[model samples]
Target: MTEVKKQKPGNSVLGLFKEIFNWYPSSYPAAERKLLFKLDLSILIFACLCFFVKFLDQTNISNAYVSGLKEDFALNGNELNYFNVCYYVAYVIFQVPGMLLMSRPQLSRWLLPTLEVLWGICTFAQSRVTNVHQLYALRFLVGMLEAPVFAGTHFILGSWYSGPELFKRAGTWFICNPLGSMISGYLQSAAYTNLSGVGGMEGWRWLFIIDGIFTLPVALLGFIVFPGVPDSPKPFYFTSDDIALARARLARAKIRKPGPLNLDVFKRSLARWHIWIFVLCYICMIIGGYPTSYMNLWLKAEGFSVVQINQLPTVTYAINILASWLGTTLATIYPSWTIYTGATGGMVFSGICMIVWNIPKALKFVAWYVFGVSGCLSPILYSTVNTVVKGDSEERALIMGSMMTFGYSFNIWVPLLLFPTAGPNGAPRWRIGWPVAMTFHILLWAGFITSLLLHRRE
Candidate 1:
């Protein structure tokens, strides 16, 4: 691997000021800036588009339920939770295997886009489900296919960008999570109003059809643009010199190239604290952030009109997008310690207000809105994992996949108990849910402290 000379830290007051506005230092070479631009256009933009549609397909089920699927299918029990359970189970099963496949240089380009295409077909098939069982099967397929996207994309990102650059890019990519959900809300609203009963299909069904259509073009584009990893065979868009510069940049940052994914890799990963600690952190953050998904169900219980239900919760996503941007920017300027503490702290506050459940209507609204900040934690956490495991590519991929696998494996049962739809504790004020969420948020703080100590000792 080629190694570039390390640039001096921009520690002056002026340098600090510049960082707030620019992602790269003013002292960076013009060629490096051009390289960043190319990477952003090819890798970052495509990653965002792919993730946006993945979430759009994934979240549309909730939107569809609230729109008309619940009534049309007469879903009276905890069927929504069952659907989520099905998806989570498949996702947990496939998560690690998918990441391992993506780790192969020969498979990286083909696997991601092919998975996207298959999932798109499944997403489209959901529109034709006449019964809940068919919908469950389709959801399982979609989840299995999408299992690789988030973790796999992060692995690809870690291979190309260094620590300082990864957060901004990862955070930017993560914004699409909320963005896709936000757009699904508006899309459902529009379809319900304008396309209801068109071709004798419910507006909710149309949502799936439109979302499935969005996935295909993006997946096709990925085959053309995705550059795999820096050490892998280069795409036509990048010249040899460009690939060398990318390697030099990562080398200077002390990021090692790919090591064989053998028994030794698994042994080394398990022996380290990185995998265990980071997995716990991810689980806490995910579980703590669960109640936000129920905001629409709460609105429905409050007797809001269908259109209002669809549009109102989008504000939460908007807030989430802003919070994600602010978190990334702050991490860029100050210590990332701020991101860990600040995001979990916000979720804890929101969860407290929710658990009380008797607060004013406006206060409840504020609680739901503030919960948006929790969405920022995922990118920051994943980026930290990438940095911590930088010396071993296979280990990094394994840890990331394991984090999602264990995290969602918990979700398979956790949500059924905590956020059940049939119990007295269900919906609007999920009595058990909010308190449980708050406790996990506190646990995330512990994880943060432990990670800090581990990093220092290393």
Candidate 2:
């Protein structure tokens, strides 16, 4: 008899580690593993960088306001809220159109980077605003450009990755939001400390300039690295065989290729409960998490130094990053419903703590830190949407867009009313904001339950 060698067990310790951490299952062929590695290196890196810079640019306004924009503009009223409203309005207007445009592979690669460049220009322009009106105009433009980045990137990721591979990747990309915010905190602190008066500009102005500068290189890299949805033009880095493998994998997972976008696609998407339910759920999740945005303001009002105000909130972002990583890892291993349940419970607990509002300072800090659990929910929810709508590419794109559009549409008026900076209810414990946020968190839990029931029925 010929000598035979025994193969190692597939469930070896190293294989388990690979599946847990690398998203690489031992069951995959060597070729498939290689393909995933390449996709991760190129597509995931670009997506993470793009999202990271987007948040950096977006959150810088808050940092700038705290650093000096508030004083320099004499914004004692609700000008900051108005700035956000301008952005939100523009964001809502462009959100669906941008996602629809991104569905066409020909446009996505160019559209993403071009929009990035435009927004970078607009972000840089914010550095020179003489009045709030000018800043408002730039904010609108930046919002319009940035609206597509989140939903569109998710759409692209959903197109390329299967369900088993998606959550961890999505979670990794989603964490960049807090990572960007975390870095922005440190950056603003540094800018204020070192560059406050350089060239007769306020430190806040330098913050925008640096943020704008940071955006351009990443945008340029997108052109080189962004592989459009696998159906789009083949990327330079991917061999034809690689492209074939990608399409094959998605097909094997039963993910449909892009369908033509027309009235029926819209009709079908709108008629389905998926869009509405997900939209409502997303809106509640976002509104419920809104209180964390006021952390810096609260710290400032509590008589903290500017450095402390800027640096302290970073702890929340750090918690957010950790929560996202752990939550997504567990999600990959556990039942999908459990992820939402845990997130909803954590957020509800935080919401209750905020509504109580008279807790010890340390307990208050704990509430804010616990609130970071909200960071993980977005990836889980969006990944669920991707998996649920995998059969219809157009519907997936539309639902993603609608989720973002309707979710943000609330911000246009909600912040003005609940989280206002003027009138009787202002920042630093806007008495109404926490209570309202708590109510929304409760609603989010209901939505989670409804979603679970619906999924089971289907």
Candidate 3:
């Protein structure tokens, strides 16, 4: 038998490689590892909690769609699409501005948790929507509130983790969506089975209620222990030395990707083809990604029972949770390559799966597998930016803002192309939409190829 090599402390590159390329697990003691896991766990739980609320919000609207939401609101195809479109508008309008404002170490302390509460309040209010207009108004407000959550989380990681650590921890944050997917799925399922008719509430109504109700307290808890940049004042736990270590560590990471400093900085950064390159890259991602958002609806239309539709997102999420970490492990070494490849490749596989969606019921499980495995690809986009950029607060902020603004800004219109008017169903028949969407994989793959060329020079 072959023996494994010993690892040294502080070998970020080697450790990352071992995680991705080797078979043996780390030899850290279970006791110490458990304790360390708890440390990361405590921090991760809050981060995951914050993510859970918003990610649930992300797909719950679609979950509502097949859960008798249309019947409740009497929504036309265009009106329902408008409800979906409004959130992206809020998301686009606020993303860069929020990142800019939150770049401050201190300002984020207030804004991050506060939005959670505010968004939670809005989520609770969504339970009251009686019209497509009301759904649009509420969803737009929810997206406006959530704009800060993702970018804010990435900026916060810059203060805390090193390059090697970013992907795994970013995995921790992104994994929550898969978990949230599972949660939303089961909750949607349970509501359909047990609660949709109880108290005269529909499953969609319960989705908003349960999500909002869970979010409020978690947001409050976030205010208590969530860490900020080393410069900020905390409640009582961190010593001055701890703060100094935090700054020193961050300073080291920043040296690797130092930000542009002059007026030319703005010109230089914007002039790069990468801005448009990644924008197109993510546009393809969202094209494939938009299908997952409608999974509950799609499954319902395919004649799966309501219970199955409600439960499907969670199973998909569980696969995603595992895949998200695995994707991180792959990216820690290849950072951009792993995700860019995965996103485009996942679209292809997922597309092929859709072509076979009419396969036997036993084979339908393959669809979710294809769906779940790609969960980690999206987070790597932000992780790639975090891995590469270096600078003082403003330049760093601009880098993140520019990447994400372009990345997400296009999503607002993407849904229109795939799910445009399809008679009374508001969703296209799977046979029609799936093929059109699959063809988009070719475009996304082209984006990935170009991105790889650009990244090789960097």
Candidate 1 Cα errors over 4 Å, as ranges: 1-17
- Candidate ranking under lDDT, highest first, comes to 1, 2, 3
Native RMSD of candidate 3 (Å): 5.3
* CA-lDDT, candidates in order: 0.85, 0.84, 0.67
Clash pairs, model 2 backbone: none
Q: Candidate 1 lDDT (Cα, whole model)?
A: 0.85
Q: What are the per-residue Cα lDDT tens digits for candidate 1 across 313-355?
A: 8888998887776676567556677676888788878888888
Looking at candidate 1, what is the lDDT of residue 420? 87
Q: lDDT score, residue 243, model 1?
A: 86
Rank order (by TM-score, best first): 1, 2, 3
Residues 4-40, model 3: lDDT tens digits: 1222324586665556643223554444334335335
For residue 200, model 3's alpha carbon misses the true position, in angstroms, by: 4.1
TM-score of each: 0.95, 0.95, 0.83
> In terms of lDDT, which candidate is strongest?
1
Q: Pick the candidate with the highest TM-score.
A: 1
